[model samples]
Target: MAKKDYYQILGITKSAEEREIKKAYKKLAMKYHPDRNQGDKTAENKFKEIKEAYEILINEEKRTAYDQYGHAAFENGHSNNTYSTFTSSSDFSDIFGDVFGDIFGGNRTKRAKKGSDLCYKMEILLEEAVKGTKKEIHIPTLQKCKKCHGSGASIGTKPYSCSTCNSKGQIHIRKGFFTVQQSCPTCQGRGTIIKHPCNGCHGQGRVETYKTLLVKIPPGIDDNDRIRLNNEGEAGSNGAQSGDLYVQISVKKHPIFEREENNLYCEVPINFTMAALGGEIEVPTLDGRVKLKIPCETQSGKLFRIRGRGVRSMQNRNQGDLLCRVVVETPVNLNEQQKNLLHELGKSFNDFRGENNSPRSKRFFDGVKRFFDDLTR
Candidate 1:
């Protein structure tokens, strides 16, 4: 019988990209693998077909020849015979690991272990976040044992090659036509065994210790920013590379000012006289206080912006504006004379009648009247 098209066997088009071809092959190979579908001869045959299709389509030269002459290109021994026979489980793992290593952490062939990364949360004041500061932090982590020097062996002794796996760190198990490779149970993939364990850290090459580090925070760093310190985390086993330490920053809420990006916002309460007559008022900024000029007849909830009085940008050193929202505070605890004077002032405004000084209040009352009139109509 004529062989099926490679693309059709892998359920992909002939114009499929390399990534698409690999993805389809991986899916089908996992689904029909003999190890996963044990005792099913149909699945075993299907897996072989998928593997053959992938092997040809993934290679430029083989694909070119196969595209021109189909399977007849390899019938009389023209092919390299790379995949003609399945010899060992290592060969199967090599092909599978090449495509899926990143998805499954890393290649299983690599037995060296790196130290685990660590995270530390540090809270700072808003002022500190804007101005930048240095802080010392204490972290409890694992450090390499001084006596054993991360080797896990006692004085005058060193680790020996694992007898179970012959120091290769992996063991192969053959089941029928399929074979599986796994880390050696005795050495745990370390490829070495310690006869005399270190007294300082037992068999483990690390000990619990507290580490102190000084972290320098950058100016204008916002909340939830992360600063990484390289190789400051737990010590790696067997002399592998150490991990990193990530310091996460949390800015505390300020009582007066709220920050949005580089800008600063604050609600400033002003007396009714100042709101109406206009005056210079003091507003707080990250850099001391600044005077903000309020225009005459300024209404409540009016915003006044002071340029270059806000937080500076860490990237470019550009400063932002400070926005002050004015809230008119009503006079309270008035004496009898003050109350009478206010009453007279209020009457004077009404006596002007045609002036319409309070246009917002007039428009609001007009809308209310129209609503009631519509209801009556």
Candidate 2:
């Protein structure tokens, strides 16, 4: 059989980024996983193909070599020949465990359970997102019990081996034709049982507590961006390591400016006189006010970009620009003298629909006239 295209197998384009590739792999892997599609030979083969493609594509070096030479890149050591072989142990839980959960728990963790990652949604001002800021957050989570020292046993006592699986933490189950080794039901895969439970954590080993952490918000952080704090999540089970805490950011909308990617956009209103004759106006920036000059006969909604005035990018360290859109404000609620002055100025033009005074209006009227004339014909 001819080897399938890796990008085609993952249902992603050639230009798909690493994150996109991972996302596509996770979705397909969850569907055709061996545990999910057991006894289905077609699904199993498809899953093997998917895994091979993912392994090659997810790595920077492998992906580059694959892109350059296709299947020949890994001809020497690639496991494409091992489609029938599969491994029982995997680190898939670190990424997709929270998503699939226990329902699709194909790759079960044989070791003690690690702490669950926690997500904290924090709303910050746009200014704070642009410039760096510090925040102190309090979260109620499970911590290792001080009384039992995270062992789940009382200060004086300790846990003993479970007799169900002979301290192996796993049991063999004969399912139809094959004997499958699975986690022991009696000990719940911990390999040990707590006879004398601690009064502080009551055998679970973790206690409820509130923790205060000072998180440093990085500059140029955008909305929906997350910052990870190591070992700041819930306490693990059976002395496993604690998981990480993800600080999800939500930037509050600014009154004067809106951010798009790295750039900032704001609408600046200019009077008809200022727009027609040209003048200097002050525009608001994150730091302070800056003067922007309006050119003569500047049209409404024209963008004026001020380079290096927007938020600095966190990744590339390149400065962004600030774009100001000018909108001409029509004169309203004028006095008699002002109205008379405007009427005289308006009369100065021979025809309002002519190209000299209003070129846009003249073209618009001409188009309208052509449309009606065509209709009449």
Candidate 3:
């Protein structure tokens, strides 16, 4: 008999997004959950099918292979050997320890563990972002103990092999007809236990200390960008390698300029006289102020681009351009003489035709006429 199609069972197309696939799987799983359909064999089988589909689709590598080659991608053999291995795995107690250690605690290996990664958020002025600068940072973390050489034992004593598991580090148990392996509870799976705890570290082999490091921040870094410093984190316990320090960048708000990608944007206010008559004005840049040319009859919100005046790309691209948006400023606090002059200027264009002179206005009024005509008929 032919097997059912996974996509058809999920009720989604081949080009469905990741979120869409998850939504479809969740809907089917909730409707056919085993506890909800206890006596129905059809619903139980459907629930199993949904579980198998999610187990494949949720994994990136498995989903890619299945999409390209179908179910044949996972047919290494036709045996229950894989299921037997899973069923005979460790019990919940030790399994929980190993999983939670990775999530909350640390590694369980006998060797020294790597230090934790550190994040530092550094703020810089816009001028500093234009040009690179070096700075110092102080961080407090756990440093390895120096008294007992990070061994967590007294000067004359050392750790001994665990007696519970006989130094094998794992215990075996028989359940029904299957044999399973579980981590040793006596030594916490470290295979060794300290006889006399160290006085300096209190048996942890580490102490709290503060460290200061100097970091050179490069130019062109934007908000949320990070610089990684290798082996600059807290000292590892015993002889393990140290982790890394990540310096996150944050640019302060500038009064004149706003950044977008690699480009800079600024609003330049121009008097109404300048909008009517052509003139040159000085505009500000990261380096200094430069002159910009405005044409006659320039309207408000007109944009002018200055080449090579923006930020350089951190990813090795050439410098970008700075864009200036012009905003026409009307004169305020005018006296009677200024108002009369403006009224005289307006009277010169009072004979302007609304149809031939303004095509946009004519088109809008024509559309309104047709709408009312259609409604009346």
Candidate 4:
């Protein structure tokens, strides 16, 4: 097989920074990953190709040699290929852990456990989200034990280091010719053992309790926006810092308005008479009711802009406009006198076919007539 340009394989320029190279590598790696593709030979080969390109480009010395001597730099006894040991048999888990720790999470090896983060989904009214408000939330969580002081040891005593792994919290096992790292079975990866455990929390060093927090929601916060409260999550093992609490915001649907990127949209229904004769009507706004002028012979679905009446932007601090779409509503439930008045009014429209009175209908009918005329011909 012919050698391909490493930069071109990763779709990056030769001067691309390390961060840029990693970014491109991650995006392509995820798509062509062997596990995701499963039994597809092409994707497996592509993943191998991407992995090979990345390993060469990510190393500084190898990258410099490649830049100077190209693919020939990695030939026998070359500076770029200095490793003497067999590397093709290295565990895939270790390689992916080193690469995807930044993209996904940390390594697969067991280490010390810490406090787990917590997430709270909060639903707020549209008005409150637009104007900003404070909310009090209560959650059940784990807090560091007052009795143990997070040491997990009984009074007047301290935890002793594990003898199995020598307080390293991990053990290495030789499988055939490969070495695999695993948590110390004696201490469960805590690197220490409490012989005299605290009576209050047994040996966990944390107690379950209820907590109340006052979350101040910012104005113009959109749905799915999260607020992070540090150290509000479950207490860490043995007094480690607590994980964070994430408050996910979800805005309730408004009865009269819908929001879109700082803009407020509303449908205003006007009676046909009010639309034809032109009049002022009251429309509800976030602040209060405002007057809207319906022009004479106003058509349905006409949009009117009320500037600066919408939500203010959180990013740029600029206010958006309120867009009111007027929908001409037909009158219903007519009395005898009203029915008679409408009948007379209808008759006055020249049997409801006058071009001047119903210009849109006239044009529509004219188009329909021409369409049929052409079809017949």
Best by TM-score: 1
For lDDT, the strongest prediction is 2
Cα shift from native, residue 359, model 2 (Å): 1.5
Compared with the true structure, what per-residue lDDT tens digits does model 2 show for residues 1-377?
78999999999999998778877887887677776666989988898898888888888888898999999887887634444424342333323442333335444444467999999999999999999899999999999888898999888888899898777676666554334657889888878888999999998889999999999999999999999999999989878889899999999989999999999999999999998899999999999999998999999999999999999999999999999999999988999999999888878764577689888988899999999999999
User: Which portions of model 3 miss their true places by more than 4 Å?
Assistant: 1-110, 166-168, 175-180, 351-377
Better of 2 and 3 by lDDT: 2
Model 1 TM-score (2 dp): 0.75
Q: What is the C-alpha local distance difference test score of each model?
A: 0.84, 0.84, 0.75, 0.84
Model 1: per-residue Cα lDDT over 89-145, one tens digit each: 655564455555534554454345789999999999999998899999999999888
Model 1: how far residue 184 lies from native, Å = 1.7
Q: Residues 134-233, candidate 3, lDDT per residue (tens digit)?
A: 8889988787778877777878888788888776566666654334556778876656788898999887777888888888878787878899999877
Q: What is the lDDT of candidate 1?
A: 0.84
Query: How many clashes in candidate 2?
Result: 0
Q: Write the per-residue lDDT of candidate 4 for residues 181-294, one digit (tens) a residue.
A: 677899898889999999999988999999999999999999899999999999998788899999999999999999999999999999898889999999889999999888
Clashing pairs in 4: none
Alpha-carbon RMSD of each model: 5.7, 13.0, 12.5, 10.8
